[model samples]
Target: MSLIASSLTFMKTPLTAKLNTQLKLFKIKVKQNTMHTLNSILRMRRDIMKLLIIHPHLSIIGGSERLTQILVYELEKKRKNIEILVLTGSRNKELFPETSKIKFKLFKEAPVKAKNLRIKKLINAFLTLSEVMDDFCPDAVLTMIQEPIYLVLSKIVKPSIGTAI
Candidate 1:
């Protein structure tokens, strides 16, 4: 009985070692596949020009809004095949006619009384921008104003995305 137990233990040790080796090889293969997929995505994005333009708000037609409008027009004119997506907090659709790609991150007034609404709004904006960046994966980010929030969020979300103020 003791000899049988010893032999069983010896077999278990080799089986466990073999399982561990297989697990390690599987992990390595998964890592390589992930890297290859990432490289392919990067290469595909590089082939197309995707621009993400962030504006604070376009509720009213101001100088900044006009500049943004002109910039988008000129960019589209220059690069016919370029893809542009405009992100804003709030916008008047009448003023900003291009509604196809313009995304709004509107923050409704919280029902519960909050101490700092500004902070809450900032957090909401950051999260929204992060989602946009992840989905769009823009090659470059163009911000109309000198908003540090956009700059910081863009860098944090995707460091590869170039930001131009």
Candidate 2:
């Protein structure tokens, strides 16, 4: 019985050593993966530029709408690394028929008690836009009209540039 117990204890020493070696190898592999991901993100940050275009409404197709589409098309053609995002509430497919690659983010219409009040609706839209801006983290924001709310929020966001046309 004493000999059997001594043999079992001796066998456990090699098993414990093997387990420790495997654990060290696993930690090394995890560190390698983490470093690889960090390097990839750094490269992407250097290569790509993010841009967001905001429009109050796009329910109708007109000169401004056509111009916006053309501008995005030309910019992408010139700079392949530029990521273009269009933010609007309207979903008129005809206005952007060829913009399959461009990202289209439909603004969420906020509900308010005074539905008839235009100011309240605009305020709600501004709040929604603020949330979207935080998520997108665009390098620049472009909008046509100079809305007072946008002006104030733009200062707070401090994007590279907030151009109002």
Candidate 3:
């Protein structure tokens, strides 16, 4: 199990302490259960398990993007039945030449005025992602960032996973 730490403002409040404790406990639980989870997956009768990894952008080389790419490579190397599909909004495909081992889908670009409309662009991104999620029907969805699409995913029947980093 991998843990990504984010800077949290330290405080004396009980909420802060509780949050820290909960994180520690969650980490321990994951460490203990990881082996069992992998064994369960190995025993599953299904021929293939589709994993959709959502990374909003891949135009730049960032830590999260690198991590996602490494994860896809490692998972595919371990399990032949696991299919990794990287869903991104990045138009610059040349930057991710290392991801030839995994499948990728460039989501439809959301049309908006070429003016300063950040909110509208975000909304379009959410809609495009929603459509992709529906079409893919993946067994699991890993969202790298918390976007409005995450909220929409929570209401769907499929399982969605999110990370703090």
Candidate that would win on TM-score: 2
Residue lDDT tens for model 2, 30-57? 9999999999999977778777777666
What would the TM-score be for candidate 2 when compared with the true structure? Answer: 0.66
In what order do the candidates fall by lDDT, top score first?
1, 2, 3
User: lDDT per residue, candidate 3, 9-106, as tens digits?
Assistant: 25556876787789889989998799778878777636677777778788777787778767877887898777677777783466455343467877
TM-score (all chains, Cα) for each model: 0.63, 0.66, 0.53
Q: Name every residue pair that clashes in candidate 1.
A: none
Provide the overall lDDT of each model, using Cα atoms, as 2-decimal numbers.
0.76, 0.71, 0.66
- Ten contiguous residues with the weakest lDDT in model 3: 1-10
CA deviation > 4 Å runs, candidate 3: 1-46, 91-95, 98-101, 112-116, 146-165
Top candidate, metric lDDT: 1
- For model 3, the local distance difference test gives 0.66
Residue lDDT tens for model 1, 1-165: 667645654665777567657867998999999999999998876766878888888887888999998887777767745678888878877766663334444433335445787777777767777787777778888889888778788898888779899
Q: Where in model 1 is the C-alpha error above 4 Å? A: 1-45, 99-114
